[model samples]
Target: MRKLPAGRAGVAPAPLPEESASRPLHSVSGTPSPLPPAPRELTVRALVMGGLIGSVLAVTNVYMGLKTGLWESGCVLSSLLAFGGLSVLARRGAPPSPLETNLAQTTAVSVGAMPASAGLLGAVPALTLLGTQPPGWAVALWGVGLGTLGVLFAFSLRRRLLEEEALPFPTGAAAAELISTLHSTGSAYAARARGLWTSGLVSGVLTWLRDASQLVPPVSLLPAAMRVGGMGPETLSLGMAWNPMLLGIGVLVGLQAGLSILLGSLVAWLGLAPWLVREGVATGATPDALRESLAAWLLWPGVGLMVGAAATSIASQVRALPAVLADLRGLARYGEGWEATASRWVARAVLPVILLTGAMGWFAFHLSPLYFLLALVLAVPLCAVCARATGQTDIAPISPVGQFAQGAFGMLAPPLPSLNASAGAVVSGAASHASGSLWSLQAGRLLGTSASRQLLVQLSGLLLGAAVALPTYHLLVSVHGLDSQALPVPTGRQFKAVAELLTARGLEGLPRSSTLATGVAFALGVVLSAAARGRLARLLPSAAAMGLGFLLPASYAVTLCLGTLLAALVGRLRPSTTQTVQSAGAGAIVGESLVGVFVSALSLMRQG
Candidate 1:
C-alpha cells in the first residue's frame, strides 16, 4: 500500500489494494470482477445512461424546488445517487469498468443541470408572443454566450478558489464515501440502482397526483396565523410545511446546510413576505409568492455568501491541482494508442459541435451577439472558480464552463422579456452546482478512470438531454398552459419580486427594517462561522440562515429545520455510519423527486 500524506484527523486517503492498480479508479478493489471493459467509443449504452440519469436529475430538481423552495441541492442528491449506485453495481458480478464508472459519474453529474437548461425553452413562447421569430443563430448564440462567460468567470478564480483552498466539497465527499464503501462490499451498486429506480417512481407518482388535483391536501395546508384584534387580518404562510420528499432532502442536507436554507426561507416567508403582503408591495402571502420572496432576499447576500465561502473554502484545496494536471498531461503523453487519440479527437469534435449548436441557438433565439460573445469570454474564468470551489479542478473547465456560458448569455440577453439579468444570476448559481458534479467526477478519477472518456460521455449526455428537453418543454407548455407567468419556469418567487421592483412605479424608496434585519442576519452568519468549531462551525452559517428562514414562516422553516436537526442528530450519534445514513436520506429525496416527475409526465400523457 502506498503511504500517502495524512489527511484531516490523520486519516489517509482511502487505500487501494496493489492488485487493483490495473483497474480503473472506480474499480480499485482489484478483485477479479467480470465487469465489461470501458467503451472506447461513444455508443448507445453511454447515451442511454446519460439520458436516463439526466432525467432523474431533472425530476429531483423539480421536486426539490416544489418541496423545499431550493433548486441547487437537487444536483447534490443526484450526484450521490448516480455515483453511489455505480459503485455498488461495480462490485457485483456485472461490475462496471473504471471507464464505465467515469462515464456514468460524469454524465450523471452533468445531467443534474438539465432542468435549468430545459427552462430556456420558455424563451420561445415569450419571443413568439412578442411577434418575433428568433432565428437559429440567436438560440445558438445564447448557449455559447452563457457557456463561455460562465466558464471564464469561474476559471479566473479557479487558481485562487480550487487550487489554493481546501473547501470541503461536502456533497462530493459524501459521494466519494458511498462509492468507496460500496466498492468495499461489491454490492453497493445494486443497492444504489434500487434506490434510483424506487425514488424515480415515487416522485413521478406524487407529481402526477398533485398535478391532477388528486392530492390537494399537500398544497392546501399552508401555515397561517390568525389576528384576533383589528391590528391586522389573518395571514397565510408556507414556512414549515411537511412532505415526504422535502424531509428526505433535509435528512441528506443534515442540520448545517438544511438550517441555512430554512433560515433563508424563514426570513423571506415569515419576515419580508408578510410585510410585502400587508403593504401591498406584493400580492398576498400565497405559496406561489413564497419562493420568489425568499429568492429576492437571498440574491445579493446569498450570492455573496456562496462566493465568499466557496472562494475561501476552495483556497485550501489548490495544492492538489498541480498533481491533477500533471496526471492528465502524463496520460496524454504515455497513452498514445488509437483509443487515447480517439478520446482526444472526440473532445475536439465536441468543442466545435457545442460551439455550432450554441451559435445556432443564439440565432434561433434572436439573442444579442455582444451578449453571447461576452458570455463566452466569461465562461472560462467562472469554470475555474467553480473547479477550485468544488475541489474538482479537472472537470470544472469543461461542462460547467459551457453551461455557465449559455446561462450567462441567456440571463443577460434572454430572448424573453420576462427573463432578465436575474436569469444570469440564476445561471451564475450554476457554479455552486457544477462544484457538486466536479466532486463526483473526481471520485471517478480517484478510482482510476480516464478523464478524457468521462468528458466525452458527459458532453454527449448533456446534448441529448438538451435536445429532448427543448421539445418536451414546448409540448408541455402548449398543451398544459405552463407559462412562466403561471408556473414561473425558472423564475420562482424571487424573480417575481424582482419583476415587481422593475414594474413598480417608484423603486427609489427609502430603506426598510427588513433590509436592516437581513444585514444583521448576514453579519451573524459570519460571526458564528468564525466562532464555532468542528461540526458546529461548519454548520453555523446554515443554522443562522435557517433561523432567518424560519422567521419567514414558522410552520415551513420549523418543519424543515426540525427535519435537518433530526439528520444532524443521526450524524452525531453515528459518525462512523454517517455516509450510509446520508445515502438513505438522499435515496428518499431521489425517490420523491423521481416519483413526482413520473406523476407529472403521466398526467401530461393522460391529458394529451
Candidate 2:
C-alpha cells in the first residue's frame, strides 16, 4: 500500500494501493484478460450498467457545459454509482470485482464527455449564434468520429505517458483509490453512497424549488441599476444566484481559482462595465438590455485572455517536443513490437473516423478536404500534448488547444466563420475526448484491468454517448434557444467572438475600444500564465478562471467565490469530513444539473 502525493485539497485524501511489479503491463495491441487470470474483467453486466449511468451523465454534462463552460469527468461518481447498483443486482455468486467496477466507470466517463467532444457546448453553439445549426444526426456523427479518434490517440500514447514517464493523472488516481477502498470494505462504501444520495436529493429539491416552482430567485447583492459619476444609471449584473452547481464547482476548484474569478468579476462588472456605460460605448434602455449589451462587448477580451493563456502554456512545452520525437524515432529503429502494433491499430481507427467526420463536415459545414487532413494531422500531437498536460496539471487545456486550432484555421482555411468554429470543434473535441479517455486508462492501469478492453469499452461508450447526447442537446436548444439567459454558453460566445474577429474586415469590423481591450486582455493572459510558477506565483491570479469570469455573469463569480469560501471553512473546521464534503459537492453538481435538464424538458412539454 502507498499514499499518493498530497494533491489539491478535496481531490484524493485517501491512500491508494500500489500495483505489484510482478504484474506485466498490457500491450497496446493485446486482448482482454483478467489480471489474476481467474475473475471476470469484461462482463456484459458491467457494460450495461456503465452505459446506463454514462447516458445520465451525458445529459447532465450537456446542461452543465452549456450553462457554465465546465463539466466533470464523472469517473469517480460513476464508479461509486456502479458499485452501489451492481452490489444490489449481483447474484449469489461473487460481487463485482474492482477491475469490473473500473471498466464500468471507464464507460460512464467516456459517455459523459461526449457532449463537449461533439461540439454541442462551444463550437456548435458559436455557429448557431452565427445563424447555422446543423441537424442532430450530423452532430452525432461529428461527436462519435472525433471522440473515437481521441481514444485511439490516447491508446497510442498510453505507454509513453502512463507507464514510461509515470505522470500523476490525479482524477484517474482518485478513481482508483476510491475503487480500491470501496471493494475492500462495506462500511466505506456505504458511507460514500449515503453521502452522495443525501446531497443529490437535497440539491435536486432546491433546483426544483428555484427553477420549476419559482419559489426562490437570485437576490441581487447591489442595486439593479446604480448611477455612477453623475451618468445615466448603469445596470449591474451582480447577485447571489441560487445555484448549487456553481457552489459545487467552487468547492471542487478550491480557493486560488475562486479568488481569481472574484477578481475578474469585480474588474469586469464593477469597473469596466460602468466605464463602458458612462462612455456611451454600451447603450441600452432597461437593465436586461444593458446587461446583454455589456456581455456582447465584454466577450472579446475574455476570449483573448483565454486564447492567450492557452497559447503561452502550450508554448512552454516546446522543450519536450524534441525528446518526444527522439523517443518515437528510437522505438521505430529498434523495431519495438508495440510501435508497429500501434500503427496497425491507429490505421484501422482513423479510416472510419475520417469517413464519418468528412461526411459531417461536407454536409453540415461545407468544410474543405484540407480541413480534414489538417485536423487529423493536428489531432495526433495535440492529443499527446493535452494528455501530458492533464497528467502534469490534472487540468486538460481543451479550450486553449481549441482556440489554437481556431487561430490556425483562421489564417489557412477559407474566411467563413462557421468553418473556423467547426474546425476548432473537431480539433478541440478530439483533444478533450482523448484526454478524458487517458484518465480512464490511467485508472485501469492501476487496477490491473486490460487497456485493450478499456479501449473497446470507451469506444462503445462514445457511441452510446453520441446517441444520447445529441438528442438531449437538440431538445434543450429547441425549448430554450441557445441565446437564452438560461443557457448563456460562455465558451460558445468566446468561439463566436474569435470567429468574428478573425473573419471580420480587419480592425474596421468591431468597436475600436473592444479590439484594444482584446489586445490588452490577451497580453495579461500571456503574462499571468507565464508567471504562474514564478516566485510571485502565490500572488498571481489564475488566468483561465479570471478569463472565464469575464464571460459569465457577476452572480456566477460571486456564487463560486462563496462556494470556495464554504469549502475552506469546511476544511479548516472539520478536516475529517473533507472527503464527505467533496462527495456532497459532486452530488450537488450532478443533482442540480440533472434537475435543470428535467425542468427544461418539462417546459418544452408544457409548451407542446
Candidate 3:
C-alpha cells in the first residue's frame, strides 16, 4: 500500500500470515533448519540503535516516496549499517551477535516502514485535497491504529506462509545471510562499506547541483528542475534529473522492472499521447500543453491497469482464505502451555485492532456501527488477499485495494467522497499493507527469532512512526508543497481523483467515452498482472513500473533504463561485479537522497 522503490528487499520483503511456526523448507537443504540456540537479541543497545536507524530511514522513505515514487527497503540496508557499525568496536566481552543484528534489522524494518506503510504518502494528501485536512496528531493516531491492526492480520497467518509454504521471503533471508556472513568473516565489510559510502557522497553532491545549486542569493526559478540541453516549447522538455538515485534505483530494480517502466513511458509519452492529440481527443500544441495533456490522460490507463490487475490477483487469494482460518482453529482452542500463552498474546495484540476498527469507524470516518463493522469485515478478506499476493510475488499492488475499497464504499457510503476515500485508505492503505508485511515477519521466524518479540518491536515502531509520519508529511508539504511541479504527490493525486469520481458520479456517472477507455485499459492491466508469472512475463513490464513510466517524463525513464542496461551488462560480463555494482548503485541513491533531504531542510529554513 506504500513504498520503498526497487523493493527494499524486492524479492524478499513480502510475507504471509499464520499463527504457528511451521517447518519451512530450508534455504539450502529441503529439511527444516536446525534451530540454533540463540543469544542476547533484545538488548538495550539494539533498541537505541534500532530506534535511531528507523527514524533516519523513516524520514528518508517519506521524502523519497513523495519526491519520486521510490521507496528502498531498510531491511538489508539497515542490516548492513548495523553490522558495519557494531563490527567496528572492540566491545566489553561477547561482540554483537547475529541474533542481535537480526533484532536490530527487524526493528529497523518494522519502524522504518511506518511512514509509508501508514499511508502518510497517499491518504493524508487526499484528505487535504478534499478540503477536510485532519489535524497532524489525528493523522498520526490513525496511522498508528492502522499499523497495529496490520501486524495483527499478519500474525494470524504467519505459520502457514512461513513453514507450510516454501516461499523464500527474500528480504528476510537476505538479512539473515548478511548477519551470518558478517559474523563468520571477521573483517570483510570495510571494502564494501567504503564503496557504499563513497558512492553516496558522490551522488549527494551531484543532486545538490541540480536541486540546490542555485540557492546562493535570492533563489531564482527552477530550483529543482535543472534543465538538460536542447530546450524549446516543442522540444519535449525532456531533461536529465541529475539525481543519480533514479539511475541507482533502476539498477536495484533490475531489468524486468526497469524495462517495464521504459515500455510504459514510450507507450504513453511517445505514442499514445500523440495519437490522442492527432485524434483531437487531447490538445498539445506546445510543450507545457503536451505535458499537461499526458499527465491527465496517460495517468488514467496506468491507474486502471493497476486497479484491474490487483482486483484479479486479490480475487484469487480469496479462494485460499478458508484454509488459513482452518489451520488456525487448533491454536484458538489450545490446551494450557506455551502454545496457549502465545495464542493469548496474539489475541491481546489483536484486541486494539478490533477496538480501533470500531473507534476509527465511529471517530475518524464518522460511520455508523454497521458501516464500521462492514469495514472490519471487508478488511479481513482484503488483508488475506494482500498477504497472499506478497507471499507469492514480492509485489504488493496497493492501489487496487484502495480502488476496490473506493468502489465498495462508494455504494455503501455514497456521495460522501471524503468518508469513502478515508474508509478505503483504512482498509486498503493501512491494513492490507500490514498483512503483506507479515511475509517479511515470517522470514524472521525462519531465522530462529520469537514471533511475539517481533510483534512487540513492530508495535513500538508503529508508535515511533506515528510520532513522525504526520510531521514529516507536513514538513515536506511545507517545503515542496502538495502539488509542486517537480514534487508531484502522485499517490495523493490518484487518491483524490478516486474520491472525487466516487463522490461525484461513480463510474457510470462519467462520460461514456471516458469510462470505456479507462475500462479497456483496466481490462488490459488485468491480463498483464495475471500473466505476470508466465515465462514470457519477464519480457513484460510491471504494473507499477508501467504506471510510473506513464506518470514520469520520458527523460527520467531513460536514465532508469540506462542504469538497468549497466546492471544487465555487468551480469553478462563480470558476474562477480554484480554485488559490487548493486552496492555502488545503492550508495548512489543514498548519496543523492541525503543531499535531497539537506536541500529540503534549506528550503524549510528559508521559508521560516
The model with the greatest TM-score is 2
Models 1 onward score TM values of: 0.65, 0.90, 0.85
Consecutive 10-residue window with the lowest summed lDDT within model 1: 1-10
Best by lDDT: 2
Q: Supply the TM-score for candidate 1.
A: 0.65
Tell me the spans in candidate 3 whose CA falls farther than 4 Å from its real position.
1-38, 215-237, 283-290, 327-340, 357-369, 431-436, 508-513
The whole-model lDDT of each prediction reads: 0.44, 0.80, 0.67
Clashing pairs in 2: none
Model 2 local distance difference test score: 0.80
Tell me the tens digit of each residue's lDDT in model 2 across 348-407. 666777888888877886676778778666666666677788888888999788888878
Poorest 10 consecutive residues by lDDT, candidate 2: 9-18
Tell me how many residue pairs clash in candidate 3: 17
Judged by TM-score relative to the true structure, which candidate is superior, 1 or 2? 2
lDDT of 1 by residue, 1-608 (tens): 12111242222243233333466444567665554433332344444555676666655554454333344433334444444555454465454333443456556656555444433422333334334454433442343334332222222232233234444444444444444444455565555556445644664455456555566444334324543111121233433343456556676555666667666665555555556655644442554464445344444343223223333333444565565444333433323444357435543453564465445544453334455446434533454445654453222322222333433444445344343332333244335334544554444434444444554554455554444444444444444443232233323332332332333311332124344443454465445544553556653554334433532334545565666787778778977555455555666666655554555566677777
What's the TM for model 3? 0.85
lDDT computed for candidate 1 = 0.44
Give per-model CA RMSD: 8.0, 5.6, 7.0
